[model samples]
Target: MDPREGEFVDRMGLVMERFGGTRTMGRMYAWLMVCDPPHQSLTELAARLGVSKTAVSTVARQLELTGMIERVPTASREHRYQVAAGGWEHVMKVQFAALRQAVETLDLGLAAVGGDRPEQRARLEETRDFFAWTERDADDMLRRWRDSREDLDR
Candidate 1:
């Protein structure tokens, strides 16, 4: 294995662990995202990630199901894996939409309070507003990120 690739995989594993994914899974995803070839065979992924091909295959399949990676077909019948372009954007959109549902739940809780507690209702409304702000700004934040990516590309 390349020493440089080892360093990259180690760092990627840490990032994946932070993001609630397995270390190898994170490393595999990271490699797929930025490797020079833009795609990796299962053997290559396993070698780089310091795991078995079967392990890489499992993680790759999971990421593929999540739309984070895709399979490329070649005339040789060998498969290569690549990180899906714009996948992070799609993931963020889905995550923010889920968060919005939490905000709605908070609103429902605020509504359940009886008429006698105006002060408590006000506080609850404030809490609800916080989530509301997040929901409202989620799209803008994603747009800004997309714009920044475009700027980087240019």
Candidate 2:
């Protein structure tokens, strides 16, 4: 693998790991995102990610089910996986949804467990606040970047 691709794999691995997913899955998804043709056959994805074809198939299917990716129909029998065309938009949307779900889970847990549990509730509150802040900050940054890009284009 190219050095740049390796870096991409590593970075993606960190991102996925931080988000409660496997590092290998991150590398696999990142490879599909940046790879030429923006798609890969199961065999090719396996070779590139240094995993088994079955593993690639499993991961690819999971990603597809989660709307992170999709299958590209081909004349050949083998299936191909690719990053969604909207790319970061799609990925961030999923991430945000997951974050929101986590917050909702925390809410339910807090309600069930009661607010008297100071330590556990503190942790949950911290996590909820962090994700909420991150979501706002990311949205603001993206908006500014888009505005700047639009200005440059004019």
Candidate 3:
């Protein structure tokens, strides 16, 4: 690993943890992102991140479920993992779906409060509108991301 890689790993660890994942998950993800050969066995990951293989395995399973990473096929029986294509896109989709759901739930709150309660209804209405707008904005951003992604590889 490069000397600067540790800083990046630490940064990503904090970032992933902020996103409600373990620091280990972020660190492993970070390592995978910058690692040469682009995929690694569980043992390599654990040793590089200074964590247990069990911890790496657990996070790898969770990350796979989230579509952030994938288990790569190897000639040997050992499993190798790497960052998945469209991972950021997958994360945004999940988050945007939650935002859409939030808007729906907020609308229900608005209905339960009724139009007669202006002050109570106002808060829910504002929140609902904001969430609806966020979903719309996210959709637009995702479109733009798709359009420009090819350039990103360059």
Candidate 4:
């Protein structure tokens, strides 16, 4: 692990808190990123993060479900976890899908509400446009990210 790992984890915790996630979620995530061997057992995570095994277990499950981390194969009954392969990219894909869904749902709303009243339609249109823009931007960024990774490989 990096010498600055604790500092980084704390910073991530603060950042994640702003995003409506528990600070432990971010700290565990940051620790996973820099931890040697990458994979960690619940006990290891708890010890390093100064949290309880139960807390680690709970947060780990949440992270796994969100596609941020994944369980590693272990012969022992105790499960170990590490950051998922392409996890950041997976996060982007999930968010992109959400943005697309939001746009679609807003479109349905626009249709149901009818277009004759500009006042009523303006807010819906603007919200739809916001999500639509986000979806388009995310699509482009994903493409660029793939291209950049390809270039790195080359």
Candidate 5:
């Protein structure tokens, strides 16, 4: 990789780390974003990123689960991966799902704590409200993205 490309990968790693992902995940994502073919085998990714195949595989699975990347089917045994289409919208959808789950968990917690304990109830309520709002906002954002995409396509 060129020095500039390496720097970009490193910066992506830092950004992912800030958001609770491993550096390898970010680097792989960055590479996929700018790679020539836009898809790569695990071995190729590992070699290019200078990481172990196992590490690359693990992060790739994580990214796949999070809707950030996808495993491309191949005739060969070795699977290929690529950045998913509609990347940002997909990410927001995944995040919205997570926030919905959080709200469910928080609701349970609030019920468990009971309304008698004002402080605990208040705290859980506030957190739950935040997640609820975030979920709604994510939905709205995705809707807007779709509208803009349609406009651009037209």
Candidate 6:
């Protein structure tokens, strides 16, 4: 890899680390984003990234699960991967689902706590409301984006 490319990969690694993912995951993503042909086998990824095949495989699986990357269909035994189509939109959807789940959990907590601790209950309620609002806004944003894209394509 060029020095510039290595720096970008390292920066992406830090970004992923901040989001609770391994540095390897970010590096893999960064490499895939810039690589020619936009797809690579596990062995190729490992060799280029200077990581073990096992590590590359593990991160690739995680990225696949999160809808950030996908396995390309091939007749050969070795699997290939590339960044998923609409990956950012998929990530936003995942985040919205998580926010909804958080709201549900907060509702349960509020119910269990009751009015016993007014301050805590208020805080929980506020948090739940925030999540609910954010979820609604995200849904609206996605809908608008789709609508705009359709208009542009027409």
Top-TM-score candidate index = 3
Off by over 4 Å in 2: 91-154
Task: Return the candidate ranking by TM-score, descending.
Answer: 3, 6, 4, 5, 1, 2
Q: Ranking by lDDT, best first? A: 6, 3, 4, 5, 1, 2
Alpha carbon lDDT of each predicted model: 0.83, 0.80, 0.92, 0.91, 0.90, 0.93
lDDT of 1 by residue, 12-95 (tens): 889878877789888888787668799889988887777999898899887887778899987776679998987777767877
TM-scores for the candidates: 0.80, 0.64, 0.93, 0.86, 0.81, 0.88
Better candidate number, 5 or 6, judged by TM-score: 6
Q: Give the per-residue lDDT digits (tens) of candidate 5, residues 21-98.
A: 899999999999888788999999999999999999999999998788998889999999999987667766766788
Which regions in candidate 4 have their CA more than 4 angstroms from the true location? 1-3
CA deviation > 4 Å runs, candidate 1: 34-36, 115-127, 152-154
Candidate 6 lDDT, tens digit per residue, 1-154?
8999999998999999998889999999999999987999999999999999999999999999989999999999999999997777887898788997899999999999998899999999999999999988998999998899889999
Winner of 1 and 3 under TM-score? 3
Model 5 collision count: 0
Give one digit per residue, the lDDT tens place, for model 2 in 1-154. Answer: 7999899898998998897778877888899878998888999988888889988888888778767788999998989988875455656766766767777777777787687889988887888778777766777766776798789989
Q: What is the C-alpha RMSD of each candidate to the true structure, in Å?
A: 2.6, 4.3, 1.6, 2.1, 2.4, 1.9
Off by over 4 Å in 5: 73-76, 112-116
Candidate 2: residue 116 Cα off by (Å): 11
Model 6 CA lDDT for position 87: 77
Residue pairs with clashing backbones, model 6: none
- Native-referenced Cα lDDT, model 1: 0.83
- Model 2 alpha-carbon miss at residue 21, Å: 1.5
- Clash-forming residue pairs, model 2: none
TM-score winner between candidates 2 and 3: 3
